[model samples]
Target: MTPRWYEEGEEPDYRFTLANERTFLAWLRTALALLAGAVALAQLVPAFSVAGVRTGLAVLLAVTGTVLAAFSYRRWAQVQRAMRHGRPLPMTWLPFVVGVVAALAGVAVVVVVLLHTR
Candidate 1:
């Protein structure tokens, strides 16, 4: 059996552990929101003149949500490991990647609108 994280390292304070859990939950909530938003956008928005734009945007959002959900667990584990080992928490790159995804979605929307109008 794989060794448990708590087995190898000292237990950190309860408050920090709880905080890490809360952060994980927050990311889960964000992922859910992104999924919901994508669904709503896909259904509620009228068909654009440019084919596949809405679908592409929706797919991108869904993928971003999936990535965030997956990465959040890894980040939480890393933070937990650090806390348990008395090491400084590692810097995360997810936020930057998420930002880039959001930016790309925005640009896609703009391009679709402009293309439809042209």
Candidate 2:
């Protein structure tokens, strides 16, 4: 009988397998980096009256970063599984990411301007 596609007698698609693994690893690394940045922001702000805004922004960033990190692996896994099953890839989160980054940037700009004008 002809061997199944995934059987030992059949040659597996090494390139596809390797590419999926690499993509997953890249996403994981990105998640870790984001979480680390958030931790740094949350830790480095000092305690002061006017520091509240900074603290808030830092906290927001930390939370967003955490969310991104948490979602990265799950999304990656979903995509990998979809690819294996020959299904459509999951929709990209680029729009949400862009919106969040833009909002964060706006907040950061306001904070910086306020600090500078003081």
Candidate 3:
């Protein structure tokens, strides 16, 4: 008997696999939007506060977006592997990470605006 390529596991349903791909694409789109937003904010937005504030905001958002994209890839792979192996999905920290970074960016923006006002 010949061992199949999926000999280590079984093939999951096509619907599930396709759904996963769609989700990955969605995350990629979100990453692209964030990156675009960063560029627009940095280059287009007038300086509401001190110089570099917009750039800092853009950098933070860009970093968050990059992290989300990386995590999304890792999570999708892990999920697919887990499904193939019939293993439980792994927990992830992406949401908390994004939230914390977003909060920090908001605080930075507030501070910058305040500084500009004074």
Candidate 4:
């Protein structure tokens, strides 16, 4: 069944629709990378000095990736709707959130390594 929104708006330009699809694909790629990182971290990396820190970071990455992957489709739909309706594009904070989370993870990795080093 088609979504109500999909039925509401006229079809948007093919180019714009394709661009939105590409953007969605890019987000999925990022999500896949994050998920892969989580798996690699949990399986390949040695345990941190602090108990559960490694697991915690891995879970964080996995959750972030899951959320991003789920939301990317919503975002793509939104952009398509906006284009179809001739409305202004919607704004998003996803990039900022991803950046902050990634930065925090990087810092945590560094701190853990430093603290654990002999």
The prediction achieving the highest TM-score against the true structure is: 4
Greater TM-score among 1 and 4 belongs to 4
Prediction-by-prediction clash tally: 0, 0, 0, 0
Q: List the residue pairs that clash in candidate 1.
A: none
Write one digit per residue (lDDT tens) for candidate 1, span 9-68. 898999999999999999999888888878987999887787888888888888889889
Output the worst ten-in-a-row residue range by lDDT, candidate 2: 3-12
Q: Per-residue error at 34 for model 1, in Å? A: 1.3
Instruction: Estimate the TM-score for candidate 2.
Output: 0.63
**Can you rank all candidates by lDDT, best first?**
4, 1, 3, 2
The positional error of residue 19 in candidate 2, measured at the CA in angstroms, is 2.5
Clash-forming residue pairs, model 3: none
TM-score of 1: 0.85
- Model 3 is weakest, by summed lDDT over 10 consecutive residues, at 1-10
Alpha-carbon runs more than 4 Å astray in model 1: 1-3, 114-118
Sort every candidate by TM-score, greatest first: 4, 1, 3, 2
lDDT tens digits by residue: candidate 4, 4-59: 88877678889988999999999999999999999999999998898998999999
Q: In order, what is each prediction's RMSD in angstroms?
A: 2.3, 5.9, 4.1, 1.5
Tens digit of lDDT per residue, candidate 3, span 1-118?
5334335588888898788789778878887787888888888989875777788889988987888888898778777777788888778787688778778878988898788779
